[model samples]
Target: MNSDQEHYIQWQKKEEERWEALCGRCGACCGAFDKDPCVHLSRDELKKYYCTIYENCFGIKKTVNGNDIVCGSIRTILHSHWPGDDCCGYKKALKEKN
Candidate 1:
């Protein structure tokens, strides 16, 4: 690849890392604060939430209560309401920007 392409790719990786860093790692987005959360949800040593199947978390999945739902990117869930909707860092950031 060209120098410009390599530079752009590196820049994109850094940007993605920066963007991911904005998350407080509260796990509210994964339905942790919901009446029923995703079955794959797990907590880190710090109590931060993560998905066990994060690499392929899209599409249909079950909540802890056995209800089925199609999971998508955080972008897809941003405008909708959830149990701990107010706790989302992305939403908080957007609110601050606006």
Candidate 2:
């Protein structure tokens, strides 16, 4: 790639990191507060939740309750419906958009 393209990619990576860092790691969006949670959800030593298959989390996935859900970026369902989503970082940002 050209130097300009390389720089742009690096800048985009940094921006993506910063955006991801905004998450509180609460796992609320993953259904931590519900009876059914994404099966890929895992907790770390620090008590934070993360996706086991983060890089390939999109598409159909099963929940703790054995139900299938189409996994997608949180933004796609920000204003939709989900259990315990009020605590999501993205949800907070959505409120500020008003």
| C-alpha RMSD by candidate, in order | 1.3, 1.7
Residue-level lDDT of model 2, residues 7-77, one tens digit each, is: 99999999999779878888877777887889999999999999999999999999988998688888788
Model 2 residue runs over 4 Å out of place are 1-3
State the weakest 10-residue window (summed lDDT) of model 1.
26-35
Encode model 1's per-residue lDDT on 15-70: one tens digit a residue: 99988877887778777886688898898998888889989999889998998867
Best by TM-score: 1
| Candidate 2 clashes between residue pairs 3 or more apart in a chain or in different chains | none
Candidate 1 global CA lDDT score: 0.84
TM-score of 1: 0.90
Against the unseen true structure, what C-alpha lDDT does each candidate score?
Answer: 0.84, 0.85
Residues forming the 10-long window of minimal summed lDDT in candidate 2? 81-90
Give me the overall lDDT of model 2.
0.85
